[model samples]
Target: MQHFSLHTHTIGFDGQNTVEEMVKQAKKLRWSRIGIANHFIVHPDIKKATFYAYACKGNYQNIYSENFEEALFKFFPLFQEIKRIEQITQFPIYKGMEVDFFDTTQWKGDFYRIINLLKPDYLIGSVHFVDYKGHLLNTHDMKKASFMEQKEILKIYWKNVRSAIKFKAFDFMAHLDLPAKVGLGYGKEWEKEEEETIALLAACGGKAEVNTSALRQKDEAYPSNRILKLLAKYEIPVVLSDDAHSVSQMGQYFEKGTELMKNAGIKRSIYPIMIADHIRQRIYMDWHFMRVR
Candidate 1:
């Protein structure tokens, strides 16, 4: 099985490992490439960071101001360090961010500004929260919610996901069926909407990710077999990710992910480095200029 992983996290955000440690683990695992994707600016409407903090029993409200610049500045160095590490190791290390795309209407302006500035090697758009009448219902916090509430959350979550793709801020949609992974909802009743969502994602340049993290939860990998088949049928590209939070999880379960893809009859999958091809082009342009000089 091919070995690589793009959806990983480190200490710059909530991840358990540091960049150096994660890289070391990747090398130990004999991975050809590993992309470090840290959490970027969360949407104000979703308030993900704050919610996560509260859920974890920590104080996150004061970590930054209303503007979010302070939190961003704090995290910027991690990206710089990732670039430096790539230079030294000569191994493929991509700079990426996992942005919460909960409500495009509310966060489109912030999302565009941050994405333009970062110019990340890639972006993983994920919907972590759903808006219900102005209140945000976090998927991770569903243990406290009612069954009806969870169903409504999934409905709005998919709607926001569609909006996120339309915004075109990410290279791939992270965990397309994330709501279903938690067993919050999504069955036959949602099949039509799922088809529509996949169609919309394909219409845009965005693709879906086959996230393996769901397996740890005893759930089928994100974008289950049925969804993967739909994506393949529509000719939508799919990327595989471990969504690893620690070094040990780097490239975790990729063999299974690839097997799932094969069973879906998907002959090809996108490697994360494909997103950095543009940078390679620019480097070539610079070299040509030097030769002319």
Candidate 2:
């Protein structure tokens, strides 16, 4: 059936399964392709993000932030492992990373340079934090909310999303309605921001994923009906993701996720092949990159 998934995690980061285990499960599921996208964030204040999402339970500083060069060094071997597995199994495995979008002004180093160096097959850009005038608003941590108004926090979330889209560093936007992770909704006040975000994604030839992980967490698909409908209205490409962290979770609830997406007006599924082709074309044409400064 040409089943494939581009958003998956492994022990390379926060996932439960190892790369080998994930591939074996994909083969059993009869998937035509599988992409391993473990977490690879870049932020100067990442150490300050003490929440579980960013902290990795005190392992973050040692594993990720301790040595930027060494941390990046650790990732290439995993890609090589993916390549080795591909050679043995002859299964299509695309190398990808789930990148954290931090405000550039607070960035400690050149993220774009690091991305180019990693040279993954593709990237999934996500904003787990909203840098509001220096204070961080974590999407996963609602208690630390510095904003007095809920809508204000929502607005910054969309603005950070806009910044990610404008940067054009990612193949697709992951979890378009991520604030929903913490019970935040796209309120009426965010209408203009939502519309403009969709427009920017469409203009950038970008796509968003109907992340099914939300089903497990929030009982809804990401990009919700409101955003998904606009994605359809704008004719923006959409893909589905299991956001799988374990072998069992691979393609978990995807049938329902696809149905949810179809109901939301998505007509096609963007697979890894399409993402690779898009990357190739962008490189060949030397597409103008918009760096968020």
TM-scores for all predictions: 0.85, 0.85
Worst 10 residues of 1 by lDDT: 284-293
Give me the candidate number with maximum lDDT: 2
Give the CA lDDT, 0 to 100, for residue 147 in model 2.
Answer: 53
**lDDT for each residue of candidate 2 in 148-236, tens digit (9 for 90 to 100):** 75667777788888888988878889998788777776567666788899999999988888888888865578877888888878978
State candidate 1's TM-score: 0.85
Query: Tens digits of per-residue lDDT for model 1 on 2-93?
Result: 57777888874667778888888888888887778776545454344436557456533432223446546755787789888888887777
Separate clash counts for every candidate: 0, 0
**lDDT scores in order:** 0.71, 0.74
Rate residue 139 of model 2 by lDDT. 69
Error of 1 at 212 (Å): 0.8
C-alpha displacement of 186 in model 2, angstroms?
Answer: 3.9
